[model samples]
Target: MQVLVCGGTGCTSSASHQLREALRREIKARGLSSRVRVFKTGCFGFCKLGPLVVVYPGQILYCRVGVPDVREMVERHFAGGKVVERLLYREPATGEKKLRLHDVHFFQAQQRVALRHCGLINPEDVTEYIACGGYFALADVLLHQTPAQVIETVKKSGLRGRGGGGFPTGKKWEMAAAAPGAEKYVVCNADEGDPGAFMDRSILEGDPHSVLEAMAIAGYAIGAAEGYIYVRAEYPIAVERLERAIRQAREQGLLGRRLFNTGFDFDIDLRLGAGAFVCGEETALLRSATGQRGEPRPRPPYPAQCGLWGKPTLLNNVETYANVPAIISRGADWFASMGTENSKGTKVFSLAGKIMNTGLIEVPMGTTLRTIVFNIGGGIPHGRKFKAVQTGGPSGGCIPEAGLDTPVDYDSLRRIGSMMGSGGLIVMDESDCMVDIAKFYLQFSQDESCGQCTPCRVGVKRMTEILERITEGKGEMSDLDELADLAREVKDASLCGLGQTAPNPVLSTLQYFRDEYEAHIRDKRCPAGVCRALLDYVIDEEKCVSCGLCAKNCVARAINGEKKGRPYFIDRQKCLKCGVCAAHCPQEAIYTA
Candidate 1:
């Protein structure tokens, strides 16, 4: 029996290591060492139910397994060959315990492509990665296929860069291969700095070898002998694993000079980047990797043409590289047949915010937003209606509930004013204010801006000021016109993608939830009761217990109730409308309108 314990950052922080030790001790104490192997692996994607434990040959998955549960699981299941009923995942609606992995709702809609070897193989173990056909893609390219043939295969696979830009992966490889440079470079953009975005980080932690192998393959394809993984310094776990994988690959003859005994002297090195969102851009990343300020440079001399110290460079994000090995091994047609006409294969998403099953999920392109939010994500929590789903990080836009049926492809999302930005899908409930959401993202983009360009630096700052004024109930209707005008100017005049797409959240909110904006401006009322300046708090006299709890907790002395079991009155003038009264109201008397 093989027992895989989740070793990803999420599970690791949640005492997965302790559980692994407990399981090992229990197995050893029972003298079941020969039959059972307890080991640490990467993320299972179902992060909400971590640290995940999977038992095979049955592929039985256990969720939220604590250290105390390990011995019982071993004694009952591993030793007695019986399933632990309480540990099994009980369905939310049916309450039926699911013993198998595929039976769970969370894993059902997911089609693991880039994430295939993630939970199944121990990332630290080169042998485990090999067992799952890890280096075979690189070996196949090295031994049989020519550089041109490899590039053609990737192009034919219809795989796009999973980074913010959905550029054709094959076209990028071809450009770098054809670029006039004797000393070219392959760069893996692992600077995943998007808010609520962990697709790249999880991939790196889960399958470091997959990325290394793909980079080797890319280096072979692009006539480059050198590669660099520009990962963020914040991802210490991912960085540590990549370093280990590189060291192991070198020791085992997978990396370094004359790899695979083929005269091709290809190698890779890690460059730690200070967490800069702009560094996610290829040029900025290249600049940062070379110990320069992480700033986006003007294009035309693209990364493929003049990159990484005036040499040709092939840059692909971590998720994009994660797909390379599979494309090489499975053949292009297998992947091309999966998604829509334009978008081929699966996309990994970090499903977060207001969703019931908050975790990492991978769904094929063309899968409806409804499917992701409802079927796969288990819908919104607390029985609240989903207002909108935000994609593409801070630069990406929000898709309203009306567009829930829209396909999650590059073109489809772009048409709806959103981009598949590193696959961060933050679900918003009805209680969330769209105006506030746009302001938050705009603020983040402005703060993270390298300020190299005026449009992003000054234009976005102006737009943020307008949003702030509106949210604070100090705006006229003309402010909306100015906001739209500024959005267009910023999008057109901005230097790089960060600036160009900075207006996405604002534009999307205006497009979908214009009424919310209007209410703030015209009525001086926040429909979602989020904008404090536009919110009104009142006490429901009939339901008020007057226990003085709300009054006691109120920072503004808004509630006035001298005696218990009597109706408490709210002094609207004194009320900050902080919702402290509503939150502390024992009888739920205080209300916001």
Candidate 2:
């Protein structure tokens, strides 16, 4: 009987380490340590129900596990041969307890490819990784396959970059191979700076060897001897695991120097990013990796032809590299059979915001948004209606409910005014203000802009100021037209991808939720009551019970009435619209308009 505890960042933050130690202590005390071994593994992807614990032989999945339950788990399950009934995952819709990991709704829809070894193996142990067919792909590529043949297999696999651009991975390798240089470099862009996006970090934390092996295969294909993983310093867990995986791989001869006596040499090193969002862009990443300022340069002399000290280079993000080993081992046709013609193979996503099941998930490329949001995600929480899902981070667009049935491929999302950007799926409910949502993304884009060129630097700032005015109920009708025109101008004239895609959120929101913007501007009201400046807090006269709580609790002293004598009313002149009176009212009389 084996017990696995999630050592991923989310669960670690929630005291999963202590829980693991507690389990070990209980198992050791009962003399069951040899039979019931406790191991710390990577993320299980169900972040909402973490810290997750899984007991093998039955695959019993325990959700939201605490340290206090460790003794009971070991005593009842390990020693007594009984399952912990209360700790088992209960289906949200049916309330039926699921004993195994595969039985849960969150795991049923997910088809793990990039995340295959994530929760399954001990990441720091290369032997366990080998048990799961880890370095076999690298061995085959190095010993049996030629450089051109490897590139051909990847091309036939129909694998595109999982990063925002969705560029062809094999084609990138092909370009780097054909480029005239002996010192070409392969780069893994692990600088995941998107809000609520932990897909890359999770992969690094869970299966760092998969990336290391894939980089070696890519090196053979691209004729590069050295590679670099440009990861942010913020991901200390991932960094630590990666350091360990590299050390383990080198000691085993899987990385560094000659492999299988094939005489081909390749190795990998790490370059730490300073948390710049723009560095997710390939050119900016290369610049940062080369000890320069993390800013993007012009294209056409793209990274494939001229990169990393003017030598040929190949770059793909962490999720993209995570898929390479699978394609190589499973065969290209096997991968190409999964998704639509254009977008083949599964995509990993970090599901976040107003959803019932908030976690990391992977699904086939052409899966409908309805299936992801309702069936897999378990729909919106609090019985609220889902308004939109924001894909592709700050540069991605918002898709309304009408487009929920749209397939989530690169072309399909782009057709609906969004892109498959780094797979950050943020579901928004009806309570979210679209105008305010657009402003939020624009603010992020503006703040993260590298400020290299005038269009991105000036255009994003002006657009943000306009959005601020609109949300503050100070916008003119002509400001909408100006905003639209400015979005197009910035998109066309920007220097790099950061500047080019910065206007996506604004344009998408304006396309789908123009009514909300008009309401804020014309009626001087926030439709979702999210913008405090546009909100007016008023007490319903009928529900007022003459309670002094509203008046006494108001720090602004906006509510004017005698104690228990007359109904309290907010003075519009004095009311700061802080909603403190509304929160303090026992009658729940106060509401916003």
Task: Please give, for residues 285-319, the per-residue lDDT of candidate 1 as tens digits.
Answer: 99999999999999989999999998999999999
For model 2, the stretches where C-alpha displacement exceeds 4 angstroms are none
Question: What TM-score does candidate 2 reach?
Answer: 0.99
- For each candidate, give its TM-score against the true structure: 0.98, 0.99
Q: Judged by lDDT against the true structure, how good is candidate 1?
A: 0.92
- Cα displacement (angstroms), candidate 2, residue 531, comes to 0.6
Model 1 misplacement above 4 A = none
Tell me the lDDT of model 1 at 62.
86
Candidate 1 shows a clash count of 1
What is the alpha-carbon RMSD of candidate 1 to the true structure? 1.3
lDDT of 1 at 510: 96
